[model samples]
Target: MTDSADTLRARLTEAGRVCGGWCTVHIDFSEDRENPEGLAESRRRSVRDRLNRMGADDATVAAIEDALSTPSGLPSPFSRFLLARDGEVAVDEAVPGAARGETLEVGVLPRLAPLIATGVDEFPYLVVRTSRDGGDVAVHRTGAFFPESTASVEGRTDTLHKVKGGGWAQLNQQEHVEELWKQNQQELSAEVDRLVREVRPRLLVVSGDVKARRLLLDAVGQAARSIAVELDANTRSDGTDAARLDAFVAEQVAAVEQRDRADALDLLRSRVSQERAAADVGLREVVGALQQAQVDTLFVDVAALDGETLLALDGVPWVARPGDETGDAEAVGEVPAAEAILRAALLTDARILTATQQATGAGAAALLRWPAASVTGA
Candidate 1:
């Protein structure tokens, strides 16, 4: 009753109708089978199984099955599709990045941003530095949100029995200064012990007259105190006081960064002997690699970045500048791509290295692990 060409056209139209509106998904096999019928059946069953596994509703599964069985000349379920080239598209969509713990440094001057509680309970620790002039003490707490770190401060609680200091100390005689120093030392020692027992600061920085310095050292104890003696022309504390406090905090944080960098470099250098040493280049590539469990270490630069932006890698969205909000749209400045990568490395606990070392071999800022290396030579 009907010609073969006309019948084929009818079949194709019917098939197209049946297949309507379904998305195309590509699945690769080890080998392509020669038998089209077998392949088609297999593909139908596979698609059904996959859809079921994906928690598709019974109605949806039935629709896909019915569409797959159509003989009409639409794109069949058995038709192969191009595979996704990027590994990111292929891998599990949940957790991305290398699975390894890392050290993070959060530098903060309390005047700038007050130290609030951090949500991460696993591998980070806090280090605090308090600097005071005669008027007010600027407490700058530098956080090493990782393991193996300490804090330090300048030495000199030396105070005079002058009008400004309430005339309490006998600074003229060596023995008197020493005796009063000892008594104040004892008192301070008791206070430090109580603070250590109560507040438990990893490090304490007290900068003032000789009495305050010695008193803090006394309060904590010589062993507990990481004291950096202030040696300069004038013993008077001024605005430079905060700078001195930051220096102390930076010094300690630097020590930790150095150790981390050394460890990372050593590990990377060792991998040079291996047959296949992996490396990633550019900021986006490194982060994608890290998420894919390929990256080992990450180096990050902190210059020209706000502290809030630096610390924002912990999951909060960061705004570089102010913006205008209209209805549903909010406009914001483009953040530096490098900063984003660095924050990722920090929050993800990837080993972080700075790029400003003196040695030729020691001047890369990066996060290190096994196999993958940063493209930025940091």
Candidate 2:
């Protein structure tokens, strides 16, 4: 049998590696409620410093910035938050044109155990958490609508404070969660009155069951925020032994990874099928195939050097052979070709990958079907 602690540690270690050497901890407060501001700020600073001590780098720093930025559609930071020693975060400045996406990853920790299990894979906001041995792992996929919010208090610790009033005595965990939510809702309503906040986020990811999600939704909805629950059987009291935590968490991560892979594969198959359909239906060869000029976009890797290319009218890549690049070209060049794929997808209200590989398969890219919404025949 695997040592529970060791298993947890391995999961954490593997998760951290997959997340580009970093993980994230997301502290979710009951909606309309505030973290102990002073406490949280102090903790955030300390965590950031600790992470720096752990040898995190510039990219990690940028990913953190991106996660916290207002444009990312993530939860706005309350009085305090932390970046921690194990990771860095920043805005993806590489997103051509308008920076539309956000990303964050850092060393795995107990705090993010919940989000890691959700495995959302849309807008590049990934939350990773690890167990004690640094062996256990968990990951969450996110997108523009899903933002990462991590909280930590410098001098304080995570402790469960039982609600005192409202006939809540002898209640089960679910009932206790409901009761806590009720209390938090009133508090959040009061807090919202204190500020004129911009970009109030819609989703909230928390650990626990229906009670926790209900509690959050009630509190946050008072301020017009939506919520998403990251289920976790572990409570705040679980010690940070890497192995014990990893076994349970690994199961959740594996499930999420499977779902993400399925979604990506479905998208690829759809694109391929669309191409085939165009060929069967069109009168002109140019209308159906990459050679004909139907492909409007071509997603290639920005990190890789894929030479000069052109986009067909549909959304496909047409690699030009030197002189073949000039004639009838609406969008030209390597960078431009990549950009066209990206922007065209965005323009036609589509999503494309520059890298063809699936995210589960290590490296992946999404190419668009058109260069631009305005591109002729698109």
Candidate 3:
């Protein structure tokens, strides 16, 4: 029921706490261009059949179908995600990292680990292809089905062509043209600056003329320049090399995530050495910390949770492992380890981070809100 991005994770996991189970789905609309709708229904029907075989109740099956019934009309190369309970959906929207095929799950918790592992950014961003005359900008946001906005920032066009000869007059004209290019960049950058402030984009990607990019860097003020990454592209709308541009975009995006992970790992290492450390290492330990609503950040390889289950109880101290409990929390059966951890993290408002590299020897780690000993005075 929450609409704020700040509390989305919490909203998702709150449903997990009271819901008996979930029906999760990720359907890629682009994989079958010929019959996208049909493909989606086929996949849904398969899950429908499976659920029916399992003797799932009518309400749960209907909830799953109703959730999946809404199709995203976004363009190709996009995917959608849905998570439903007995008769209501908690999460339903478009997302990045298009699955190669239909992925459906009926489980103990909402299947959100795979999506989180895709490094979904929760903020808006701008991608621009600029030239000396103007820039083409596309605004993108997390879970947005398509580019949220687009703008063409054009300035004076008369000064774009450069002079080739070397006479005093030509040299003067060349200087004039260079100055005009700067003016054009200033105009484009001003629009970009406005957009950045309005949307508070997490990053800005500018690609086009080298000279224009330099001018943009100079003109854009601190806020925009701080997150701007100049792509080595010589495109300006027309005749854009689609393949090359996609490759560059993917590479830059991956690089940004890598830098973020590096910083997190460094902090994790530094914190772990302290006497009253606010960090937990290993999947089991992290899960234990999550039960206390103590996790501030979680680091893990999503792959590690595959085919693995975690011991959990139905109520307080929701997570546990063998030889690790002594209370009256009733057993809730084995739950998917990844979903359990993800659910706990979400419920407790913890940041879920996919550790692309090794975080610890145990395939998972977390920076807790407090030291382990402080949690429930264990």
Candidate 4:
């Protein structure tokens, strides 16, 4: 429900590390067509039984139920993710996508890879559906959990008409109408500039009345203009073809993600080829860098870690192979490899980029702030 990334970061970072006694739930609470009310109860009962078997206390179960019952901020057909520790809801999210399936795990490090896969947003965009006088702006925030925010600019209809059948007197009224249009465009442009600054969206999608589109684009600052894109699917002044607008937005966002993903991969390969060790591939090296907070971004292939297990320590670099935990950690336990690595990445403030198993051979890799040799003493 919260719009702030800082809030989620602060809550998770506060945990530092916890090996067990945590309940992580990722499930679809979207309205069930067959039996909406019953589905909710069924999902809850299934989780409650599992957690009870795992020795979850009453508070933990209550916290989980409260989060599930709460309404989501995200649009419909989205899944809900809740992470609870010490009888408190630590992380709660409404991810915008169809649920793959239900996942309920307890006594493990929070299963965060799925959360990252679904909740993480990178390519922010703004869709401006404009008209002669003003327009509606849908702002997609950068790297946001809840991505949708809205604003609108409506101009007075009194002087919206252009030149009509008239004499010189009416010609003066036409001039007034043109002036009003310019004024409205300017006002809308100023608001767009403000939103661009606040959201820092990667794309400014402009649509609607062609004339207003041009005028608003012209009125906006140079920076917004640079990224502004014009779309032609305007059904009417008051509304747009929703499906077409949605598809275009999806296409634009996908293109950006593909470009960025390629750029990241290329950079990793180049750093490795050049022998900078600025990039570390596989678990041992990446985990080593992460321990010291050296990772700038962590690339993880969740498929590679599917059904895999890892040992976790209480603090400092937090991960170890099974049977290796006894050396340092005062508290240690076995947890999902994907969860442990992702948790470490988040705690160290490293950005996570989910990769396919084909791209990353191991469960994890990292682009580091410093050379790996420094950490490994090679």
**lDDT of each candidate versus the true structure:** 0.36, 0.33, 0.73, 0.75
Q: Model 4, range 281-369, lDDT digits (tens) per residue?
A: 88777767776788988888877877887766687667766545344554366777777787778778887788876775567878888
* Deviation in Å, model 3, residue 377 alpha carbon: 12
Q: What TM-score does candidate 3 get on C-alpha atoms? A: 0.79
Q: After superposition, how far is residue 178 of candidate 1 from its true place, in Å?
A: 4.9
User: Which candidate order results from sorting by lDDT in descending order?
Assistant: 4, 3, 1, 2
**Model 1 / residue 126 / CA error / Å:** 11
Stretches of candidate 4 exceeding 4 Å from the true structure:
1-12, 15-20, 73-75, 119-124, 142-149, 164-173, 235-237, 322-331, 375-378
- Measured against the true structure, the TM-scores of the candidates, in listed sequence, are 0.33, 0.32, 0.79, 0.87
Predicted structure with the largest TM-score when compared to the true one: 4
lDDT of 1 by residue, 224-276 (tens): 46533332212234435545654555566456555655776665556544654
Model 1 regions lying over 4 Å from their true place: 1-138, 142-180, 190-219, 227-285, 293-297, 301-340, 346-378
Query: What lDDT would candidate 1 get against the real structure?
Result: 0.36
Error of 2 at 196 (Å): 17
The order by descending TM-score is 4, 3, 1, 2
RMSD, candidate 1, Å: 25.9
- Model 4 scores worst on lDDT over the 10 consecutive residues at 322-331
